[model samples]
Target: VVYYFQARGHGDYDSDFSDEESGEKSVQKTKSVKEDDLLRKPFQKAKQGSVVHRRFAAEEWDREEARKRRFHLISMDAYQRHKKFVNDYILYYGGKMEDFRRSGENDKTDLDVIRENHRFLWNEDDEADMNWYKRLAKKYYDKLFKEYCIADLSRYKENKFGFRWRHEKEVISGKGQFSCGNKHCDEKEGLKSWEVNFGYVEHGEKKNALVKLRVCPECSYKLNFHHR
Candidate 1:
């Protein structure tokens, strides 16, 4: 077969190249020409233009990036400030409890003192501010205690812990009232009435390890840490 094909091609030089090779060469040449054209076209267009548009686009992109960075910085600053606020508030309440002790209220249970202090911190209009406080507390506490590992509750085991609490403050008269707070059931509805939610704290450990003296429920959820 080799001899036969070699003879057919006449003297081993492929005097008449096969159609396939010819077609392949033609494709290669066309591809090279197209690529060269593509390369040159971009340069030609760029040369025709003053590069002003490209510079403007680059500058705009930089400005947009800078604006995004500024927003991020501001958000981070706000978060840090809020964290300090929560820490200070907790410390203030703890200090207030010291006052109670000095005033001969040392016989009061830790829970009792915490409850009393929380009541003192609250006003009738406190309900309106509860949600905002909740959000701020979650954000800052999560960052300090979870992400930055700044606050080790185990270190301050005996420190007073507080919470923005929502309890079963008596089921609504007649049918129960459900707030739209349930995520799983958006359409869930029931009898409606305002439930009193107040902020409270406890000194020392709670049964739930997550809700123990180390961290509050709101911060636990924010940090995605298991409570108990």
Candidate 2:
């Protein structure tokens, strides 16, 4: 059953998911998730419309833009043979072959690019904190290999760019082009990720924006509940 989770503030601990279809089916639960200083400390400084939030958001906008512009799609063959967690593509900043810092094969994956090249890639943070970031980055990337990067065989090869599973021989145009438009997902290819128009908002003076997103599959399932 598809459900929507209501975010409860930290430390209070009550979290719940309400079934979209039944409306009466609501499950209340507590999450054991531990938050770090970002949630407790930095978050205070990063308040909406504050100087801190604006500063990081602007820098993040630029860095994310650069990552997409520099993306180099690795062949499917490389992804399959990967001993570690696989990625959609790699990043190259200089836009040239020799700029790769790795020795021998000069091979570096998106997995390591951020940590190794943080000074260049991450512009928002102060330079003095980069060393701490480097250590943190290492642990995070190692965890990435274990956690979020797992290749789900069920969801595998569904063609992340709005394509059907390979088994379907015939398919209609504009059919399976999006996963979900409800919540945000992090596949790391941010600039042109699969975006399906969710809805529209009317602005008094400015043009209306058609909301679009690439969200997790569970959220995607909610879209079909009403149709059934």
Q: Please name the candidate that would achieve the greatest TM-score relative to the true structure.
A: 1
- What lDDT tens digits, residue by residue, belong to model 2 across residues 1-228? 997766664544543442343344322111222433425764365345645577788999999987775453343355454522222223322343344345767666655565354321122443455565465554443332110111122332342322212112111221122322222333322222233322222222222222333335554443333434
The CA root-mean-square deviation of candidate 2, after full C-alpha superposition on the true structure, stands at 44.0
Q: Would you list the C-alpha lDDT of every candidate in the order shown?
A: 0.41, 0.36
Which sections of candidate 1 miss by over 4 Å? 1-33, 37-48, 53-228
Query: For model 2, what is the alpha-carbon lDDT of residue 170?
Result: 13
- Give the TM-score (vs. native) of candidate 1: 0.17
**Cα deviation in Å at residue 154, candidate 2?**
25
- State the displacement of the C-alpha of residue 143, model 1, in Å, after optimal TM-score superposition: 32
State the local distance difference test value for candidate 1.
Answer: 0.41
Error of 1 at 95 (Å): 28
In candidate 2, the residue pairs with backbone N, CA or C atoms under 3 Å apart (3 or more residues apart, or in different chains) clash, namely none
For 1-228, candidate 1 gives per-residue lDDT tens digits of 354544545355665558678889999999998997877854364344445588889999999999997786677777686666666777876544343333655576544544443432323453456554344433333332211111222322334332222233312311112322221212223312222222233334222312211223333332233323
TM-score of each: 0.17, 0.14
